[model samples]
Structures are given as C-alpha cells and as structure tokens.
Target: MSDSNTTVFTNPSSFILLGIPGLEVAHIWISIPFCAMYAIAVLGNFTILLIVRMETSLHAPMYYFLCRLAVIDLVLSTVTLPKMLSIFWFNSREIDFSACFTQLYFIHCFTVIETGILVALAFDRYVAICNPLRYSTILTNRVVAKIGMAVLLRGSLLTLPRPFLETRWPYCRTNVIAHTYCEHIAVVKLACADIRFSSYYGLLVIFLVTGPDVSFITFSYIQILRAIFSLPTKDARLKTFGTCGSHLCVILAFYIPALFSIFTHQYGHNVPLHFHVITANMYLLLPPMLNPIIYGVRTKQIRDRLLHLLTHKGT
Candidate 1:
C-alpha cells in the first residue's frame, strides 16, 4: 500500500518471482528432483509423440487424443519449470512484465486445454467401449480434427482475457510474486485496485471450464462402466475394463493435484507458503511425468511399439 513500494504506472517494468518462500535455502536441493522430473517429462512426452506419429496402426482417435495430451503436457511444463529452475539454481527472479503475463496466459490456457483433452479422451473411450461397432464411424479423422480444434479454441479464447484484464489494473502494491511462475492469483493480488471482478472471473473460468469438463468425463466413464459390466463374459468385462485403466490413472494424476492446487489457493489460508508452491509445481510436473509412463506401461500397443523402437535403434 505504500507509494514508495508501488509502481507509478499500471504495469511494472518487471516483476520479481520469489521461487519458494521458506524453501529458498533448499533451492539447489529442490532443483535436483525438479530437474529430474523435467527431464523425464520431456523425454517421455517426446517419445509418445514420436511413437504415435511413426506407428501407422496407432493412428486412431484414441492415440490422436494421447498425442494432443502429450503436447499439452510438454507446453504446460515448459512454460513454468524452466523459469522456476532458473530462480532456484541461479537466483534469477526478475521477469519482464510482458514475459510474465505471457507465462501466466500459457500456464492457465494449457491447463484448461489439458482438462478439455481429458474429456475428449473420456469420450473416445465411451464411444470405443460402449459403441464398439460404430467407433470408427463416429470418430472419424474429420470428427477427431473438429474435436481437437474445439478444445484448442475453447482454452485459448477463454484464457485470452486474463492478461488483458490484468493489464487494465494499476499495480500500486509490491510487485513481488511469491511463487515460482507468474500465477494469476499471485500476480493480481499485488494490484492496488479492487480485484473483485478478477476474482469472480477466475471462479467463473473454473466453473465454466472445469465444471463441464469434469461432468462430461464422469458421464462418459459411467457409460463406459455400464457397457463393460453388461458384456456377456467375465473375461470380456475384465478385458474391456482393463482398457480404461491407463486413462483412469491419468485422470487421477491430472485432476487430483490440479483441484488440490486450485482449492488450496482459494481457501487454504492456514497452509504454509511452501506447501502451496510445491503443490502448484507438482500439479504441473506430475501429470506430464506420469502420463506418458502410464500409457506406455498400461497400453500394450504403445508399450510394444516403444520397445520395438528402442530395439530397432539399439540394433
């Protein structure tokens, strides 16, 4: 609130990112694991993309959705982790105003994109399992392309307003963000003006994006479960249910941490600052690291193809 601490203009020249508040002393130690996770995520996601692109038989709606998810994961992590690591390793905390806003937009936008893609994946399973006979017809290349476009547009357009809305506010308060990246709430809280509209819009974005996506995913799975159970043979039921296992794991890995991070940011006043930073980082890192591993391990086709690729390279 002090004028001396405030920026004179609407936007500050740059914002300082405090990597992790209480854990600053341990930053080097922390970056070790964070760097490892980043490496794994990068390698795993690229492998998924490569394998899916190379294998002709894997060119179906399901794999196409997986490829989309991989790209989202890569972008999601890349947007945040490198900057976070820079802060941790080199104590490089200053980010230009425009660069920070760009990071903020990409982080939220891709998060929503990931959420939408999860719903698409759920729907792919629903059609594949519940309506096996019509899977190919219902989810043709054209239809899949349309769904991908819709998901991309929905995320990009919805989050486009965030940076603009932020720029409208004059940041008269301190410009130090206490988390790794330019998180929306963290950055906006530094504004001197009334932030009620921004707050409400944030909640609205969640409700509009996450609310419907979660509902659709749940509905799709219910139908999938019903179809699996109705199969005539136990073997058929088990075999069919097995197909959804990787997706289920992926959904849990993605949403559980994400929802935790969101709710904690909204309401967990008593929680430690380090807890928040760690949770936020985890939500971004864990899914990207785990998603490809989950699919590679659980999906036989991908696993075999991955093995074949490795073997061929080795030979």
Candidate 2:
C-alpha cells in the first residue's frame, strides 16, 4: 500500500495486526463462538431486566440498582458484540471511519456509565447495611432516578471529548481496525496527528471516573466486613456475609479483568497479540455473562423468583 493511503503510523496500511497476514481464517473460527456468546449475553441481561421490572416484591433499592446494572450490561455488550458478530460471520471486517468513531464514543460512554452505576450500587449497599433504620428514607425511588441520571450525564460528558478530538485528526491511511470493535485507544492511535494530549486527557478521565469509584467501593466493603464481624451471633455474621457475597463476586469479576486489560494494553503492549485479543474480549464479554448467574445462584430472592417465573411460563 502507498504511504499516502495509510495513516501516519510506525506500520503501513498493509500491516497485519499481531503479525497475522489476514483475518479471514480467524474470523471463520471465531464466528460461531462469538455468535453464541452474543446471544447468551443479550438474552440473559434482558431476562434480568424483565424479572426486576415485573416482580413487585423485588422493587426495592437494591433491585432498582440491579435493574440499572442489567441495562448497563445489556448496553455494553450490545455496543460491541453485534458489530463483532457481523464482522466474523460476514467476513466484512471493514468499518467506515465515521461509524468506527461513533462506536468508540458509545463504547467509552457505556463503560464509564457502568463504572458509575457500580459505585452507586456500592453506596446503596453501604446505606442499607450501615444505616438500616434510615435506609428506606434515604434511598427512595426519586433519589435512585436522580443518581441514574447523574451517572449517565457524567459518562456522556467524559467520553464525548474522545470522539470529538479524534474527528479533528485526518485519517489519510488504511481504515482497517485490527480489533473486532473500535476501541478508544486503538482508534486514536490510528490518527495522523499528535495524540499525546488526547491520550493524557483519556487517562485523566479514566482516573477521575474509576479512581474514586473503586476506592468508595473498597471502603464500603471494608465497613461491611467490620459490621459483619461485630455481629454477636455466628449465624448472623454468616448471613450478612452471604447477603453481600454475590455483589462481591460480581464486583471482582468485573473489575479484575478490566484493570488487567487496561494494564496490558497500556504497559504490556509487548505481550503477544493473541493474548491481548483474548483478554480484551474477556473484559468486554465476561461481566454480562457472569452477572446474572452470580445473582441467580447467590441471592435467594432472585433465584426463587426466576425459578417461579420459569415454572409459571412453562405451565
């Protein structure tokens, strides 16, 4: 490929990601699995949303936050999976520059929003556990709605600059994105202009959004653990831990791979391309898949309600 037709990168337009010559073979092999995962993620998250909406008994602050989470998971998975599945199945891995940027915007937006939602959920748990007498008055439906709106607004504001900055750059080179979806870093790296400012801004936004969120979550859990330990009876302590176990499991599953992917992409770029791709997909796909299962098995109310719904539907 000619230099004029490629972006100003270290590599040329014909550069194969991960040193693989073409994506045709990989696409064929990955299509089936990707399709299955996409289907499962969509259906599972949708079911959780429906269950939360329909079950009046489950319409508490916790379930309200859960419903919000289900929506976020659905949006997050939907933003990337369908496009990815299409690429794999149709062998049309090409994405228009504008569409790629749009995808990148939403991907970052949903990710930020989900992080905020998780933080909000942690706060909700904290209120319930630490201030049982005031929990009802504190976490009313109106308050949850306001929190949801704020989270969405913050996510949108933080990620809007990324795509806006990307659009200003001229893409004079090949448009082939090696990854399945148009990731923020990957797309920005393809720009023909200096991206140091953009990168720094991106990192700053990430830190602002995730740093305090993760810290608050950790603090909430610490206090929860302390409260559990202080319970006079062994059974009470066990029950308290058991009640929060599902949330903790989901939190770990969501954050650990996410941080790993971030570290690998930023600092461990020298690692194998296949490894990066696998970990990236795990970060994108695993939380949605595991979240429903975690709640279903760990939370008695959700599990019983889901089972009842299934049995009633069968009849």
- Candidate No. with top lDDT: 1
Per-residue lDDT of model 1, residues 1-315, tens digit only: 244255455567888888998988999999999999999999999999999999999999999999999999999989989999999989998899889999999988999999999999999999989888999999999999999999999999998886788877788667788889998878888888888887788788988998899899999998998888788999999999999999999999998998899899879999999999899999889999999999999999999999997899899
The lDDT for every candidate, in the order shown, is 0.91, 0.78
- lDDT minimum window of 10 residues, candidate 1: 1-10
Candidate 2 accuracy as TM-score? 0.91
Question: What is the alpha-carbon lDDT of model 2 when measured against the actual structure?
Answer: 0.78
1-315 per-residue lDDT for model 2 (tens digits): 343345454333332222122545777676677677767877877888888888888899888888888888888788878877776666555565667778778878888888888888788878878888999999999999999999999999988986887787765455555676776666666667898888799779968988988898999989988888999999999987787888888888899999899899879967876677767877988888888878878889888888998899899
lDDT of 1: 0.91
Give TM-scores for every candidate, taking all chains together and pairing residue i with residue i: 0.96, 0.91
lDDT accuracy of residue 229 in candidate 2: 92
Model 1 bad stretches (over 4 Å): 1-10
